[model samples]
Target: MISKTTIDRVFETARLEEVIGDFVQLKKSGANFKGLSPFTDERTPSFMVSPVKQIWKDFSSGKGGNVVAFLMEHEHFTYPEAIKYLAKKYNIEVEETERTDEQKQEADERESMYLVSEFAQRHFADMLWNSELGKAIGLTYFKERGFTPETIKKFGLGYCLDQWDGFTNAALDKGYRLSYLEKTGLTIVKPDPNNPNGTRKFDRFKGRVMFPIHSMSGRVLGFGGRILTNDKKAAKYLNSPESDIYHKSKVLYGIFYAKKAIAKEDNCFLVEGYTDVIQLHQRGLENVVSSSGTALTPEQIRLINRLTKNITVLFDGDAAGLRASLRGIDLILEQGMNVKVCTFPEGEDPDSFAKNNELEDIVGYLEGNAKDFIQFKANLLAKEAANDPIKRAETVRDIVNSIAKIPDGIKQEIYIQECAGIMNVSESVLFSTLAQIGKKESTEASKKQRQEQKAFDVVKNDATVEKVDVQYELERKIIEILLLYGNNTEKFEDLVLKESETGELVLEPESVEAKVYEKIYLDLQEDEIELANERFRTIYYKLIEALNQSENFSLSTFLGSLDQEMVSEVSSIMMEEEKYTLHNWERKDIYPKDKKIGVAQLTSETILTLRCFLIKKRMSALQGETREGTQDNRETLEEIMNYIQLNKLLNQKLNRVLS
Candidate 1:
């Protein structure tokens, strides 16, 4: 747990623009900042950051929050993780409260696994730098690959000793649980046949160089180990088993280092190994990542898509390897992204090419050699289908199938024309083939949509069957007003309806000045109407308590004391108007009548509206009782008539014309 003082200091020191600008490119727009939405693929800017308000709202996705909330949403960091990230950025010291042994034992399962993985990374790195065997073996291998000491350390390279239980024993001696170690795949356990109820434990990556895999926010999720010895009996490379914290298909090597570069360069270079990424980054081409020798998955492609919409895939000169990886291009096209392909010279991969050439030469080679996916695919397939009509026909069909994956109609037509010219076929023939493929795809898409809609209908029907509390909206509105404008003080006008000597009601408006909180509290107390929603009621009392306690209230300070759910609610309320602000209402010839211009009138009207609603509700209940003949006594009759008169007066004060 983080200490309250440290959390407060962090909230005070971290600027919203400075913290979010690390990941996004924000341009100043008046007093606020605007940028393309990081959460979605948008060409026009919809993400806005307000320094004055210390909150940000992405109008495109409806996500808004304070500095810490943005980190949690953007980086998937837990509350403490987000706080620590900001604290580090602003050079604020983080002081954590000591946890009891019982509290430590009760930690969450996923968090425990992450803790073990983090410890193993440190342990392996220590071995690589400090251990004699690690220096002789792991450090020597990295040096041989032309990896500088700085580069190796940057990637968190490490080594595991060439022993059966070196890592397992170290982790155990440090009081780390074997169960967590095994769960993280850092240790392997096997049953011992020699002794009943006994198990044997060994390190999984013994005798290898370690490459720690990190999430986008730089949390160590897992490790990849390369065996140093030429042992044909063992696999050349080993990876951590899938655990709660690591999903291999969803992670890409070097994303943590490459995300900013990818966003800045507006393109990514896809490679096949960890060293390919490291070597190229060392060459100053920082926008590169690898599939880590696994087949590219849609999840991995989407990860890259978040940073940019263009990808350049680098392949070795081997024709067989190029052909084998050609299918991955269609996956990129399916995601509605532009893809280009580049192949290195014979005997050179990304690592070797970067090592053998200057940075400018390597970059020039890539730019000159990169070809659109369609052109590259067509040229390669044409070579393979030389002088054979049947083979040529199949190549055309294969190219058309890839073209169908493209979602943009204009791009598809352009590619179809390009294919026609390359294949010596007429444009009409290619278009006919494309139409057949499109029809089939449409039918399948319609079927999927129907299934999804049916599931949605089931949920909608279930929700409709439940009774919805109507007063919940009014209660929520009251809370929203309190959170956004509770601390503000302004002049208010109270309209009083009095009985004249002629026995008629007369309206008189009187001017008064007070804080909004004081007016709202007194109004609610006079009416004796409690908030109808439980969540709203809790927030209401909390806001009142905060107002009474603080001499000058700060939103960020108040937010620090709230739980995650309440923080989300408060942020939503505070930023709801920002959407309209982003739309530039002036451009649309629409102007929002300024409610703040008459804060007193707005507050008085809001409270009167609530009172009138409650009065009408009471009148209806009394009418029901009168019809049922359940309460027809003289006193009850008088009470019913009196409520009717009071309802009329409230309606008049609210300027509602009675029918």
Candidate 2:
């Protein structure tokens, strides 16, 4: 467990915007930061971070909380892991109580795999720098590739010794479990046929140089290792097998190092391998990542989609394997992102190309040579289809199909026109082909939907309608009001029933000045109203106590005291109205009512509405009792009448007509 003192210092030092900005591209909105939702595939900015409140909200996914919550959600970190990440990021010394043997044994399985992978990375890097054989074999190979000492260290380059059990023995000696070692694919184990109960083990990447693959948050998920010698029996490059923490299709090499730069430049350079990423970064080009030669996946594309909508895929000069990568562009288009292609000179790949040129030459070449996906695909296919009618027709269909993958209608129409011009076909012909492709796609999608529906035996409904939960909304509003204005003293004009000089009961405005929390608590207490929602009721008491005890209640401090569930509740409530402030509502001459202008009125009305709702609920219960019960009919009738009168008075004070 992390010490309270250390967690507090981490919370104080680590800024929410700064930590989230590492993975997201945040642009400044008025008083807040807005970005594309990392939790959803979105084109518009729906993720909002309020530095003032020290919380973030994803309007698209409805996930909201403080900085720690963001890490827990985005990075999939356990609570302790998140705190430790913050401590590391902000340079705070972690003070954790020593774990007992039982506690150590109870650590999470996925986390155990992660720890093994990280330790392997360290062990390999240490061997590369310290061990004699590692220096002679692995270090020499990286130097021959023109990587600098600094570049090598920056990427955590390492070497596994050639001995079969070198890494396995080191990890075991350090008390790392063999199960995790095998699970992360660092140590491969096999049954020893000679002895029934014994097993044989070997380092998976023995005699190879290691490149650590990290997640966006910089935790080593796995490694990609390159062999130094040309052993025909063994593969040239070896990657960690898919485990709990590392999925090859989902992990982008160099994403941890390149995420900030990718967002800053609003573009990404997609490459084919590990060194391609390192070479570019070493040449001062930082917004670059690779699929590690794996075929592109939607999950990987969505990872980049969270940062920017623009991608410029970098290809080597070799025509082989070029068409395979071209298909990945259509996947990008499906996600509503822009795609461009840049190829190096003949006989040069990104690694060699960047290794030879200065940064200026590289930038100029990429800028001057980058082709839009449409032109690039057309030009490449036209050469192969030269004068062959069948191939030419097929190429045109392929291009049109790629265009059809675009989600935007306007872009589709514009690209169809552009493709017509490029292929020397009429626009109408291309449009017809695009239409056919879209129709086929829609039909297939509907077929799949029907199949899924049949499998689940779900009933078809005309619409998915949701009725309003009035009590739930009222309880939420009460919490929102208390959170936003609990510390502020406001003048309130509440309607009080009084006897006038004419001896008739009439509602009169009774003015009073008190803190917002004071008014809310007193009103609820007076009515003996308990929140119907259990979660809201729990938060209600906590908020009231915190507000009453502190002269200055800090929202950040208050948030730190609650569990994640309540923290999410408070953040959503406080930030719900702030979403209207995004996209600059006033500049379009459509101004929303400023919430600060009438906080007092809002608070009074909310309390009045809750009282009305509860009273109506009580009257409904009494009516039900009158129907179901045989005794006490007169007293129950009088109780219903009393509740009805109270409900009417609350509705009147709220300026609502009772229907």
Candidate 3:
């Protein structure tokens, strides 16, 4: 367990901007910083980070909390992992106490999985650097691919031996659970063919160079292995299957490493392979990430969109996969990303080119060669179409469809003009086609939205009706005042309702528990009644006890007295509004309004209001009573009229004081 001292240091030193800046590009927006939502694909900024509050709110996804919570949400980090991350960021040494075996056994499944994954990462890394076969084969292969020692270590590159059960045996020998190994897909388990009820295990990535896939916070989630040998039947690459912890579709290669740089550069370089990422990073272009050679997914693009809107995708001219990969540009556009495509020279990929040339030269080549998506598409298609009208028409449709994928109207218009210019087609004709596709898409989107709205409405309407009670609102307002003005020591008396022997209303002055809102409400009531807002009411009682028991109260100490949820809610409310300064009123030549000045006048006004309400309530209660000009009812009506006239005079006096 992390020590209290360690936890205190973490909270004390952890800066919101500094911690979040490691993964997200945040631009100053008023007192808070705003960025693209990490949890969704958005062009416009919707994620907000408040340095003063040490919290973030993602308007798009509606997930919000402090730094620890952000880490838990975005990186899937445990509380301990998040604390340790902050500690490391602030250079605070952590102190921990050892736990018993039973206590360790009580660790949650997620934490255990995280621990097991970390162990596996270290195990593979050790094998890569230490094992004879690993050094001779995997290390040799990495070197042959022009990967440096620093690059290999930076990426946490590793290797698995050729032995069938090598990794599984090692894991078991270390007292790690065999079940977890099978669960993580590090080991393949099968029912023994020879034995009736027994199972056999083999390493999943035998004789493969390992690449550790990490969560945004850098915890090892899974592995991606590349084959070294020229085995025709064997697949060239293998990834860990989906498990309780890792989802392949949501994970991107090099995100953990590239997130900071991507945010810093305000752009991300999208590539196709793990090598492409490693090579670019080696060449000091650390803002590059790969889709792991898969088709660009909305999830993957969203991940990049969190860090930046601008994306430059690099494709190799030598590779036969250009046309197959071109579809990704449309996906990028759909996510409202600014996409540019760059192609390396024929017979060269990013990896080879980086190795052959200096970093400056490589960067310059990429910058110079990067072409806007529409222009690249038009130029590539123009070569194929030549002067054939039919082919040109097909190309125009393809470009228009790509433009239709863009969610932004301004970008679509700009791309349309560019496409027309490149295709030698009229802007009007191209726009007409774009309009048709866009209209269809919009109609479908609207239909989906309507369906979703209907579902939402059904759910909303199905909710049980809650009875409206004004008493709850009154109690909440009282609590707000108590929480705001509780510290003031000046004597402030409030009127409480009391009942006399005749059951007539009587006003009594009460000096009650300061900041004890529930007590204040109870004290005011002629009859004892419990207030709603149960959580605050509960807190109010405890605070009263604390205040009565102690000579002096500290706001922070009082705040620290509650559990996490209560603290969060109470603190948020308390800090939402600033203290109204009498200084400002004084500057405007206004005197501080004495809170008690209107008390006598407000008393008459209150009686008048209550009389009106009581008369109505009584009338409702006496609905069956056929009291035709009865003496009691007549006297009640006459008394109410007199009180209303008196209230008019009271209002004039109160208004004069307020003015």
Candidate 4:
């Protein structure tokens, strides 16, 4: 477990903008920073980061939280993992107590896989640097590929010895379990013939150079190993098998290194292999990542989509390579991202091209040669369909399919016109084909929606019904007031009922000043009202405790003590009104009434509303009891009359007119 002091220090030292800016491209907007929502597909910037509050909100997705919460949400990190990541980023020393054997055994399965992967990364890196055979072979291969020592180290490049059990033995000796080793695919285990009840283990990436594939936060999720020897029976490159921590289809190689660069450049260079990413990054082009030679998946595209909206796919000039990668362009287009294709000279791929040229030449070549996806596709396919009517017709349909993938109507029409001119076909024909494709896609989409709706209705009908708590919103509002204005002292007017000279009860108003927290606590206690939401109730007591203990309460300090869920709820409530501030209301000739101006009235009204609601509920229960004859008839009658009068008084205090 991480010590409280270390966690506090981390929260203090880590700046919200600096931490989030690593993954998001933030542009200054007044007092806060705004960016396109990483949690959703958005053209407009809806993600707001408030450095003053040390919290961020994605208005698009309705997720708001502090720094640690963002990491947990975006990177899928555990709490301790998030703290450790921040400590490393800010250069703060993490103080953690050693886990007992039982505690170690109780670690989460995903965390265990991560720990094993991290151990493998370190072991391989140490072998590459410290072992003689590793240096002689793996180091030689990397250096021969024109990768510098710094580049290799930066990427955590490493080597595994050729002996079958080298890595497996070392890991076992380190007290790492063989079960995790097999789960992470670092050690391959099989049934042993010599021992009846025992199993044999060997290294999975034996005789290979290792490339650690990391998540966005730099946790080693898996590894890709390239074989040093030319073994015809073995594949050239081997990747970690699917496990609790690693899913290849959802991961992009070099994302940990390239995320910031991709955000900074507002563009990404998509390539085919791990070396392609390292080599390009080594050559000062840092915004490059690889699919690791697999077809691009929507999950991977969404990963990049969080960073930027423009993707320039770098293809080798090989015809087969170009054709295989062209399919990825449509996927990119479908994601509402701009797609450009840049092919290297006839013989050179990104690796060789970057290694052979200076940075300026390579950069200039990319900028000058990159073609729009439509033009690139048309030109490449036109060459193959040259003078063949049937092939050309098929090519036209293929181009139309790519065009139809575009979500924007204007873009599709423009691309269609461009395709018509490129194929020497009529615009009418292209339009007709695009319409047919769009209609077919719409029909398929509707069918899928109907099927989904049917399933949803079945589940909805079969699921246990939950009673909606009508007091929830009122309870939530009261909590919001406490969190935002709890410590604030303001003048409040209280209405009191007193005996007049004629011996009749008359309403009178008295002005008083008190801290908001004190007023709220007294009001709720007087009425015996408790927060209906369990989470809200927990936060309420904590806030009251903080208020009672501290004369000078710090929002940031108080926030650090709460869990992620509370942090999110508090931030949402705090920033709920600030969303209007983002609209620049005054500039648009629309001025929103500021709630802070009547903080006392808002607090008093919220409490009064809750009191009124509870009174009505009591009255209803009394009426039901009277009908059921479960209570004394006279007592129930008197209780109902008292509740009615109390409800009327609350409504009057709330300035509600009687119907």
TM-score of each: 0.90, 0.93, 0.79, 0.92
By summed lDDT, the worst window of 10 consecutive residues in model 2 runs over 456-465
Report each candidate's C-alpha RMSD, comma-separated, in the order given: 3.3, 2.6, 7.2, 2.9
On lDDT, the candidate that comes out on top is 2
lDDT of 1 by residue, 1-659 (tens): 89999999998888998777766767777668877677876656788888877888887887878889888887677788899988887899999988889978877777788888889999989999999999999999999999999999999999999999999999999999999999999999999989889999999999999999998878889999999898999998999999988999989999999988988888999999999999999989999999998989887887887667899999987635777798899999998889999999888899999988989999999999999999999999999999999999999999999999998999999999999999999999999999999999999999999999999999898784657555765677677677767888888777677888999766677888888888899879977989877777887898999987886877788778887777777777766666666667778899888666776667787787788788878878877777778654666677878877777877877789988
Please provide, for model 3 over 454-529, each residue's C-alpha lDDT reduced to its tens digit, 9 standing for 90 to 100: 9999999889888866455445544444554443443334454567799755555565334333334334464343
Worst 10 residues of 4 by lDDT: 575-584
lDDT of 2 by residue, 575-598 (tens): 898788776777999977777799
Put the candidates in lDDT order, highest first. 2, 4, 1, 3
On TM-score, the candidate that comes out on top is: 2
Model 3: ten consecutive residues of lowest lDDT: 575-584
Q: Could you arrange the candidates by TM-score from highest to lowest?
A: 2, 4, 1, 3
Off by over 4 Å in 4: 25-52, 56-64, 451-468, 568-592, 625-636
Candidate 4 has a TM-score of 0.92
The runs of at least 3 residues in candidate 3 whose Cα sits more than 4 Å from the true structure, single-residue gaps closed, are 40-44, 59-62, 446-531, 538-659
**Local distance difference test values of all predictions, in order:** 0.86, 0.90, 0.75, 0.89
Candidate 1 segments exceeding 4 Å error: 16-66, 69-78, 450-469, 548-552, 576-602, 628-632, 653-659
Give the Å error, residue 271, model 1: 1.1
Better of 2 and 3 by lDDT: 2
| Cα TM-score of candidate 1 | 0.90
Per residue, candidate 4 scores C-alpha lDDT tens digits across 477-573 of 8778877788899998877777789975556889999999999998889878888789899999999999878878767778899988899998887
